[model samples]
Target chain A: MAPIKNGRHLFNEVPVGYPVPGKTTVYDESETIDLETVPLNGGILIKALSFSIDPYMRGKMRAPTKKSYSPPYAIGEPLNNHAVGLVLRSENPSFKAGDHVWAFLPFQEYVVQTNVAHVKLLENKENIPWSNYVGAAGMPGQTAYLGWKIFSKAKKGETVFVTTGAGPVGSIVAQLAKLGGLKVIASAGSDEKVEFMKKIGVDVAFNYKTTDTVKVLEEHGPIDIYWDNVGGATLEAALDAANPYARFIECGMISQYNQTSPYGVKNLMNIVGKRLSINGFIVSDHMTPENAKDFYDTIPAMIAKGELVFLEDKKYGLDKVGEAILDVQSGKNHGKSVIVVAEE
Target chain B: MAPIKNGRHLFNEVPVGYPVPGKTTVYDESETIDLETVPLNGGILIKALSFSIDPYMRGKMRAPTKKSYSPPYAIGEPLNNHAVGLVLRSENPSFKAGDHVWAFLPFQEYVVQTNVAHVKLLENKENIPWSNYVGAAGMPGQTAYLGWKIFSKAKKGETVFVTTGAGPVGSIVAQLAKLGGLKVIASAGSDEKVEFMKKIGVDVAFNYKTTDTVKVLEEHGPIDIYWDNVGGATLEAALDAANPYARFIECGMISQYNQTSPYGVKNLMNIVGKRLSINGFIVSDHMTPENAKDFYDTIPAMIAKGELVFLEDKKYGLDKVGEAILDVQSGKNHGKSVIVVAEE
Candidate 1:
């Protein structure tokens, strides 16, 4: 396939409401995003299909502007997080054309940035659906592996409490913990999510909206690990229900994201008292360039072993980009939200 | 000095009011207080002169408290924190009679215990004031040393924000930072403290009670290392003023100790956004028997070299122990509070 000629870029925009406007805008002139352009220099160009719409992105749109696991998004600057794409062009000596890649990318059609280290320039893109690269095969996958393997140390028979049990990272983490032979207790926002979590190997799954977080966790008995994807009241409840020396792996705090003020986790003081280790981590921080080899091997092996089963909710066409980001931020999309930009 | 052989025991209590009826109940007993003889096990005899009444002691007062830097105090029993005294007798083989040890001792005159790892058996007391074993030359000294060196990686010309700057750890840490050639900005509660800090080597000292934390910090400009003693508002202010990639060493959060419901730091989001490293540490965690010698030697040199000056706020007698603890907790003690139990 040859490179497309320069043209206007299309993006999604939102009007004020429950759903940000699902409208599209076309720029009068094409912006040169090539790495070699201006003071910036990366001939690097990746055509993104799977961009992560994480809970942290919604935090950027907060009303009073609250602090988040990730910085709040400015009014509108093409929100970015994790993305798995194919390198269409490579200026760096390390990368080659047609290479599969995963990097922190924007909710846009293309990304051409220099010095994006956490981004993995993948060698094999076969058998594994490109979508999984953003889901079970990609960052959400790594978030689970590193968090459970390193931070949480989710051991066999240990109980894990995971918030947002049906979402991307939380879902994978729950599955991984279960695979590691740990008992999983999870909190979801909706009944459907609860059922989905249970179906995917959670021992105890509850809709936090319908159940008292503390009461549900209490009924679940003792928990040794808390995977915090939803970090407001559930985090507090988990803290109250934790056994001594519990590990709370803070993947992201979706519950408190868009609120101008923080969603208070009153039991945070328990961190010091119980000798609990509550570590807030950006999954990218855990990944090294070499981790990609494990990724290329594990995703396929997990699939063959019937270990990892993941889902994707795709919003197609570049025009739907804004709506996709909105859906991603609001956490309305089930599983991972990926944008299909000129799908191959 | 002659030892008492009264064959009688006295449980004398002095009241303090911070976390609770803050009291130090000294044991004036001639009867064996050994763990085998007492109602409980694991007891050793301690001849106490100075007991450390630290900020962490407040956490122990609560029944089901958060994870702590120090061990929790048992209910209805004598509490232990950092202490300096002689071992009168011991069931624990690591200790013996007339051994001048420094421990996180019980708030008693004599402590007979089985848990000796809880105590740091002293080989050298150096004929220094017993209070120094718990104050400037002790835990606070180590706290400052470790917090600066370990967590903050304190460097020259970099700005440092130290709250409760007139207190033991803060004062010692400030001078140490000065010796390391860093730009030090301190915040305390009063004018007298401001002057004392200025006299003993603080480039900028603001009275937190008088000046605004945010404004004062901004006026001082970018802070690279924040040695937070007063958590809550001062911590929030420090967070607001910190430079990108700044390090926050949480040595103590004394400001929130007295609050029944602890306050949330409004600007804590800065930790993630700025990529700041905010670490909570108890200096005791960094010390060992081998390093304790080095720590002891270093302080004496700095003091003798006039590179460090220790400020002592003397309380008249052992009975004034209650007042000294209260004064320190309330920030009324301008410097290190020394209980003049016996004259050197």
Candidate 2:
């Protein structure tokens, strides 16, 4: 085939605060690749289908010297995240042409995968939307499933307070808690998101921006579990309203990610008096083969059977990746933000 | 028997900040009780021996409307705490005259107990000092033991950082962590206390007042477990120095107990990145019959065998109760502060 236009989003510069589009990240479509002859080195060549834009990616856009759970993105390199792609050509037996696969892929139109260690072949027998694989049935989905399964330890009739309830991970966690016989109190930034939370069967859904978090919790809670996605004031509120021995699952703190100075949580002393258990976890750590298998066998089937659902805020084309990430960081995106790089 | 002088410390007023020595706690000695004629009411009339003065008592000095794990002290009532006493007379079958017992007794020269639910018959086969029951072999010891045993999940070759390392609970936790084959890094306010920490087998002991806590932890740690006794800046430092999956046993937060505004912990975001598990507990909650039996069987024997040791800062008379509590609240007492009310 002739050389074709290949678009990519490159990490341009590390930002002091919230990343600036076109400055922190540069969209480059000047590059070209010969689809039929790109070097694979016994690996597969993939055409990017969709990319998951998440708040955690902001943590990666830091100075390389700063240590975190995820490594910093190298300046001038393609920003990478969870992406679903089509295997165009393959030399590896595990993947073949026309097979859909999910892997940590760079934000680029085409990828030449020399190492296949992080790649997993996608099996969509029920034919769910390709974007769902990057959102609901993908990393975020597994994050909610594994985190809830391993940590929440939810008992029937217990109350769970979930922050960022309309977001990918929180939505799933809230649904799981609701289905598992828990009284779910969830919060989101917007009234629309709050309505979405109510639609999803949340017992008490509120717009955190308008409501006093502590008062709401005091009136409706003494939450047995706290699924914390937006940390800061909500966390302090949760602590105030938590029942004795409440379990706090620290998944993400999207609110503080872009701040130059993180929020100072005051009432941490409640941890001692209430005998609260606060656990912080990175979901990728629990993605063992057994756990992944269990997640795939259950969550997708639930989605297919209409028992579980997820909302996607889709941004068409690679050019929208910067805006999508910023939206996720600022809580502007109402659901799992995804950049649909190409149609299947 | 003739009437005897019975002195006690009474809760006089609730203060906003630190409990005042004479104003918040008043020394009352006007009332005298006849040792022979005092009504037992199916309980026991006891002569108070030694009382444990701890920082936790500061929390009980709040308004009655405020809820806490421990009930707030009633105004104009005698202050109560862990005490080792001798039964002067007994109407209950469980106790006999002259039998030593450990119970939650008022800080008084003499006490009349109607309910024996909180009392435990003291069996000192080795005849350890009566004061030790109110310090080393008592609640503080059990607090250290059970908190360490149940929450720490410590493994050999791991590192543990303990704050308030010379205090009753932290000292025992430090020693226990040291003996458990973990690298123990402990901090104390004074140089003398740091020396005591070293003597008790802490691998690295520092005076937190003189040395920067975060610097010391960074140099000696990546702590696997944090036995948090002083929970303000030190807790934040521990979070910064913690290894992935660090277990924090939130035994106490003495530093924040008296502060009107609790410290705003800025680094709780580290909880998620490091995958930390912080568990707060009240030792009394875990004191089931089985656990209490295990603790009594093991800890006392350990003290007797010289496998465990504790320091006691003894206040000679019941008049010193107010000062003792003040000293404990301010972290002025080097060891387990106890007011010796009477001789056994």
Candidate 3:
């Protein structure tokens, strides 16, 4: 073990409505950390390679609260998310040095993971890039798969409407729905993102910023299912467009995530007449053995066969993390936003 | 059969926000009609004894649109609902004169039913009143039974929150939940209604007008299940008060039915973190033979044992129908609002 210079950003204070520019800060050289400690029993010491920046992180940035699904980042501590890394040292018998692992870790150059369950060695059998573990084919892809498979129960010949269709989870959901013989309608913030959704074989793609969701649905509904990633107005539109016995899968409310006062969903009365079912879920709850097996077996095959496509908006270094988060929060990214912490 | 003077009320026009005084009009010197005229071979001529005035009629009063669950009342046609009657004449082999039957008919003194399926012979076991068919022991009772049996799946020792607790459907839902060994919390519009809910074995009851729903929930929350008969603010509070994996049975949105613009539920983001499932259904969709059998076999037994109680606010004649509707809409009725169109 030896002292190593570790540069990292830490969460300073809770944001009011949106993250302030100084909410996250990269330390000066004088504050560099020493990575001299050995990993605890069943633990691995790793160098961070890449990190995911998602809309859900905005909820965590609020003053630490128990109401959030995941634990909030402690003030003055580095924020954490799904990350891909290279193992520099291992105190666990199951893993060794040079192992490429995936774990829930912070945005730091190096770290010691004491929980073995949170860490997994990456298997690159098809020569897939390591960063894919943090984007599609990883947490996001599995999430899309499980939500579609379990919640939506999308059937062949059925029509589906997906909001935030260009984001990591929504994009995967659209592709999976298309592959399942469903007619897919997708909505995104920007025209570029809308084009990307159409490129991925969505039956209909619209820029929600320019197009009225209810108007689009008036022509195309009554939709059989609505895969909701962005709630609020989009959800109200979906509620209006839904057919009898329609299923609404609530995955994320990115539309309301940063608002000081979240939008109230009107037209919920339609639920009764339409016999609608709105179910909300977190990805971690659906990571069963069967779902994991299906995710690992089916998704990569779809990718290799060109039947599925995923986009990654990657920034060059850890210093760009805060800006990357801002880009995601503002819906500037066309796909999964990731920060490349170090070169492989 | 001879011509008889028949007095009835007809739907004149759709209401803008709430029904105006003349939204429905009673006939001045009603037309006399011959009962001999039969539209179809299988027909039963009946005298309407009693009719139900329910909240769902508000939707029917909207500008006749195909979007609503039930068909709108034709501008000049008599409004229809569940009514008990005496069969005056019959050409159908399934019925005979002097038989008491229930059917979806109008508020007139008499009518002809060509469809046998829409009418059922009433069973008077344990000397249950015939009008009870339109109240606690009939459609509303069956609805409460099925919603709880299918949606809530409430376990003993769990807690349930019911909105509109003094209404026919809401009252039954609270009692059923209590009988199933769950602590029941109910909300109503008036102090008298709150007292009624408490008398019906509700563990906690509140007047929603004076007490803030969210504040009440903040004290007694993390509720297990919310049986929503009144949506809007109460639904928002339920969303906030929901514990992990809470189920919300969407029965009715009485508060929003008449509004030109419905209330927007604000705390929907909590659905994702809490993993809540909000489901809606029309009772007709769930009236299986098994459910009907259970309702007939169990509910009457509970009533006989004094384990269940139901109230009916019965107006004397069809002339009182409009006032009864307004009472139900304004949350003034202490129980199920019904019109005794003819004396027993």
Model 2: DockQ against the native? 0.87
Give the docking tier of candidate 1.
incorrect
Model 3 agreement with the true structure over A99-176: per-residue lDDT tens digits: 898888887888878887868777766667788888787888888888888888788999999988989999999988
Over B90-199, each residue of candidate 3 has an lDDT whose tens digit, in order, gives 98988998899978897688887788897888766766777888888777887888899899979999989999888889888998888789988889999999999989
Expressed between 0 and 1, the share of native interface contacts present in candidate 3 is 0.86
Tens-digit lDDT string for candidate 1 (A1-344): 33443322243342243335434323223444543342326657777766665555554554334434455444435556677777767768878777777777765666776776656766543566766777777777777777677777667889988877888888888888887899888877778788889889898898877788888787885789888776666667787888766876766665554555775444444544454655556666656656656666776578546677767888765556566666765667787777666564
lDDT of 1: 0.67
lDDT tens digits, residue span B64-96, model 1: 453444555554455556767776666666777
State the lDDT of candidate 2 residue by residue for A1-344, as single tens digits: 89999999999999878888888998999899999988889999999999999888998999988899999999999999999999999999999999999999999999899899999988987678888888879999998999999999899999999998999999999999989999999999999999999999999999989999999999999899999988888898999998898999999888888888888888887899999999999988999999999988988888888888779999898888888878888889988999998888
TM-score of 1: 0.79
Query: Taking the tens digit of each residue's C-alpha lDDT, what string does model 2 give over B1-344?
Result: 88978998899999888888889999988889998898888989988899999888998998999998899998999999999999989999999998999999877888899899988999988678889998878889989999999999999999999888899899899888888999999888899998898899989999988899989988888889999888988898999999989999998888888888888888888989999999999999999999999988888888889898789999898778888888888889989998988777
**Residue B279, candidate 1: alpha-carbon lDDT:** 58
Runs of candidate 2 with Cα error greater than 4 angstroms are none
Task: Give the C-alpha miss distance for residue B64 in model 2, angstroms.
Answer: 0.4
| lDDT at position A212, candidate 3 | 89
Measured with C-alpha atoms, the lDDT of residue A321 in candidate 1 is: 54
